[model samples]
Target: MTSHADQPNVARTLTGQSGGEIPRDDWSAGRGRLFLLLVAPSVLLLVLLNAYPVFYAALQSVRNGTLISPGEFVGLSNFAKVLQSPDFWHSVRFTAIFTVSGVAGSWLIGMALALLLRAGVYGGGTVKVLLLLPWVVPIVVSSMAWNWLVATPDSPMPTLARMLGFETPLFLADPLLAAITVCVFKVWCSFPFMMLIMSAALSGIDRSVYEAASIDGATGWQRLRYITLPLTARTTYISWILMTIFCVNDFPTIYLLTAGGPIDATTSLIVLAYRLVFQNFQTGPGVAIALMMTAAMVVVSLILFRQIRKSGGPA
Candidate 1:
């Protein structure tokens, strides 16, 4: 019963409500298909590149096998042997020390640097650039530089100490000092990343919060302690988790500088695994150690992720 004029009006109404000639429902179907197409390749690639290798390694770790030797279904025997080894124990101890010290140092230094940069102080840009330089440089190059600086007998640090009328402290000679040196260098190399992340997080804060705090006579330290720090908790937590993983797995700095020596004093879990796998050709224990380290990192990451989610957040 509708006339041509009424038909045109009905068509215009439908188009107006839909926001275009195409219906919103139709647009959604097309967008969904496009998204699926875009994501499919990445999903497949991840499965092939990451998931497969992980499951394969897990399978290999359970069985007595090698790239060169025949396989046997040993089933946790390797894990048992690794748990009892003295070298493994030493590596674990070193790893704990390294993870704790390195991560803590990185967190503190990063926070300090971020705060300094945020303060609009003089030379802030220059300092940030210089700090970032270490992180950008290749790990091998940084480790080499550290090695030269800490070399025995007439090294730069020692010479500087002597010039300042202080006795030369052997950096890599004493085991304790050597470990400390590694931790310090790692902190220097790592803090920049933390600084960068924390700075970004700081930028996202509501400026009004700070203004209000100031109007209420909140001191600088009080503002930072209560407002800024709490707001930055997520970023700080993430930095801690990442730094811990990296510290635990880091081999280049420890290997190049101290080689975990001075009687295995600086040796870490990753370094010990590298030595076993490559140096001694003990593939079994080496693989086992690597797997254990990986498992630890995974567990820690999962815990952190859960905590983040539970706090009404996502990372």
Candidate 2:
């Protein structure tokens, strides 16, 4: 429908050449300005939400005192004290145990479930949705449900244990049992996330590779060990790193369940920080502990980022 006279303008626009009806440089400048205007508010909000508290916390960490007095700039004494504390080390040990156990348990279960589903289990869609229910539920609600199931003497778990002839059924009262219980709870809530990721990774893998391997006389176990795990190794590592951070920073689950009870057996660093600041009124040490945890997380995140890049994951 274009006439010969109007063809030049249409051709220029189609080729991204803006000189016919608009100057090319001016159009580009306008687009750049529009992009900046649209993005600036979000950038500003992100800085305020994330950076400001970090700076404030850093400043607070150096000052010694209760929250009100904030005594004086102690020049890392707070951090030194925290590092030297037996209680801090105890919490650190438990935190490591909790994080490792949770990450490993969740990942294993998730991968297993993924494999089962990948093999085309009956009712796979329904099962997948059911598995995610725990995760979708509020943490407080989930913690309370778990508490009801195990914490009390007349609880179903204890009642079942008593009926089964076990004398002591205080699952949350014993130190080792408490630690295990928390780890199990963490796995229960976390496995769905891992399953979703592993499933996606498995799906992306070309089935033809497995077909080829099988044609070459690869058995079921052999294909799994050689093909599946290797192909999904990067995703598995990513899941581990992510779940490690989640377990490390998790507070609500432990707090609502145990409150670090039974001699501080389930106390993670986050719980310890909360206790120091709010319960003990030691703001300086609390902030220092938090900052130390932040530093540790940063180190772990950097390692993970490097690995992700090496594995060709998104930046």
Best by TM-score: 2
TM-score per candidate, chains pooled: 0.86, 0.90
| Model 2 alpha-carbon drift over 4 Å, by segment | 1-26
All models, RMSD in angstroms: 4.1, 3.5
lDDT by candidate, in order shown:
0.84, 0.89
Q: Write the per-residue lDDT of candidate 1 for residues 149-230, one digit (tens) a residue.
A: 8776588988898999998888999888988898888887888888899999898888899999999999999999999888
Which residue ranges in model 1 land beyond 4 Å of their true spot?
1-27, 30-34, 163-167
Task: State model 2's lDDT.
Answer: 0.89
